[model samples]
Target chain A: QQQVKQSPQSLIVQKGGISIINCAYENTAFDYFPWYQQFPGKGPALLIAIRPDVSEKKEGRFTISFNKSAKQFSLHIMDSQPGDSATYFCAAESGGSNYKLTFGKGTLLTVNP
Target chain B: EAEVAQSPRYKITEKSQAVAFWCDPISGHATLYWYRQILGQGPELLVQFQDESVVDDSQLPKDRFSAERLKGVDSTLKIQPAELGDSAMYLCASSQELGQPQHFGDGTRLSIL
Candidate 1:
C-alpha cells in the first residue's frame, strides 16, 4: 500500500491564481510532514513543512495545511507564478534514524504566464 | 549554499553490466539515505545510514545491489549484473539531525538497456 496518496497528477494555473495540491497519509506514527519541489533532471528540494501540532505553516508564497485527526494535509500556493511550475511531492517521516521519506506520487504543476 | 553532490549525473549501460554511483553528503550531516525512483512513481528507500553505520537496508535488493558509507561521509552504491528493470533515478540525501529535513543531490539517472 502507498503510505501517502496525492491527487491531481497534473495541474495548470494561470499566473497570480491559487494553486492547490492535496495529500493523505496512512501511518499515524508520522509526525513530520514536508513538501518537496523538483524540476526536470533534478533532485527534490524541501519547499515547506508542517507538524501535526500546528494547523498550518507558511513560508513566503508556500503554505502547508495539516489536519491531524484526518491524517491528511494539503499544499497551497498563493499568487502562483510561472516560476512555481514544477513537480511537487509530499512526504512523511517519523521520529528517529531518518528512515528515508515516505513520498507521494508527485503532482506536476504548470503555471501559465 | 551547501548541497549534496552526486557523480555521473547520467549513465547508460547494457543489461547484466556492473554500474556504480557515488554521493557526498553535506558537511556535518549525520544521517544519509539512498532512494530509487521509477518513472511515474514515488521514490522508495533503498537504505539509510546513521553516520558510518547502517540503520536500515530492508528494502535494498541484496542479491544484486550493495551500498556502503565509509568514514561517515561519502557513499557508493553498486549494482552488479544490472537488469533492464533497474532503469531509474538513484537519489542521495542527508540531514543534519535524525529527524531534520533532508537535502538531496541532483541524482544519477541510470538507464539499463
Candidate 2:
C-alpha cells in the first residue's frame, strides 16, 4: 500500500545551501519518525529522528520537522556539503507494532562543490 | 562506537543456488532485524527478533527465505533456490529494545545471475 511516500526522488544543491526532503505517511498510528543516510555500497545510518510529540528536532546540521496532524515530516540539512551527498530515507514505526520500520522510497541528494 | 557487523560484503550466485548472510548485532542489544533493500529503494523489513525469539516475520518469504538468531546475538538469513528477482542488499540492524533507535550493518550485496 506504500504507507510512506517521499518526494523529489533526487535533488541537487550547491555547497552551503539548505537541502530539504519531504515525506508523508498514511498511518496515523505511527509515533516514531526517523531519517537515515546511506552511501553507495553501504547500509543506511541513522541521522536524526523526531516523535509526534515534538514539532522539530535538530542534531548538528540535520533537522527533522514533524507535523502530527498532517501526518507529514521533512528533513533539512543546513550548509550542505559534498560529503553529505547520499541517499536519504524516512521511516516510521508504531510502538504497538513491535517497532517494525516502514521506510520511504528514498531521495538521492547531490551536493555540488 | 558499537556497530552491527555483517559478513560477505558482496556475493554473486546463479539462479537456483543457495545463499546465506550473517549478522552480529551490537553487544547488549536485545532486538534484531533483517531487511532487504533493492537498488534505489529504501529497505524493507524481512524479519524481526527479540532475544532469539521471532517477533515478526510476516513480510518474509517463507517459501524460500529463512532467518534465525539462535543465540540471541548473532543471526543468519538464508535463501534457497535463489531467483534473479532475489538480488538485493541484505541489511541487519539492532536496537537496545523495541521502540529504540536502530543501528545497521554495512550489508551484504547479493547479485543473482
Candidate 3:
C-alpha cells in the first residue's frame, strides 16, 4: 500500500504565480514530513521539511504547511519560476523505523515563463 | 559542501547481464540507503544500512539483487541476470544519523534491454 498519496499528478502555473502541491499520509506514526525536488537526470534534493509540532515552515520562497490532525501537508512555491519546473515528492518518516522514509508518488510541475 | 558520490551516471545492459553501481556517502555519515525509482514514480527504498550493517532490505529482490557496505563509508549494489523490468534509476542517499535529513547523489540510470 502507498503510505503517502499526492494529488495533481501534473501542474502548470505562470511565472510569479503561487504553485501548490498537496500530499496526505495514512500512518499516524509519521513525525517528520519533507519535500524533495528532482530535475531530469539528477537526484531528488531536499527542499523543505517540517515536524508535526509545527503548523508551517518556510525556507526562502518554499513553504510547507502541515496539518498533523488532518494527516496532510502541502508545499507552496511563491512566485514560481520557469526553473522551478520539475518533479516534487513528499515523504514521511517515523521515529520507530530508524527514520526510513516513505514517499509519495510525485507531482510534476511546469512553470510557464 | 559534503555530498554523496555515485559512479557510472548511466548504464545500458542486456537482459540476463550483470550490473553494479557504487556509492560513497559523505564522510562521517553512518546511515546509507539505496532506492529504486521507476519513471513517473517516487523513489522506493531497497536497502538501508547503518555503518557496515544492514538495518533493512525487505524490498530488495534477494535472489538477484545484493548490496554491501564493507568499510561503512562506500557501498556497492549488484544485480545478477537482470531483467527488462529492472530498468530504473538507482539512487543512493546518506544521513549523519537516524532522523536526520538525507542527502542524495545524482543517481545511476540503468536501462535493461
Candidate 1 chain B worst ten-residue window by lDDT: B36-45
What stretches of model 1 exceed 4 Å from their correct place? A96-98
In model 3, which regions exceed 4 Å deviation? Answer: none
| Number of the predicted model whose DockQ against the real structure is largest | 2
DockQ of each: 0.77, 0.94, 0.90
Residues B30-77, candidate 3: write the lDDT tens digits: 999999999999999999999999999999999999999998999999
Q: What is the lDDT for A80 in model 3? A: 99
CAPRI-style quality class for the chain A–B interface of candidate 2 = high
Ranking by DockQ: 2, 3, 1
| Residue B55 displacement in candidate 1 (angstroms) | 0.4
Better of 1 and 2 by lDDT: 2
- What C-alpha lDDT, on a 0 to 100 scale, does residue A105 get in candidate 1? 99
Score residue B66 of candidate 1 by CA lDDT: 96
Can you tell me the CAPRI class of model 3?
high
Q: Candidate 1, residues B31-56: lDDT per residue as tens digits?
A: 99999999877788999999999989
The list of candidate 2 runs beyond 4 A from truth reads none
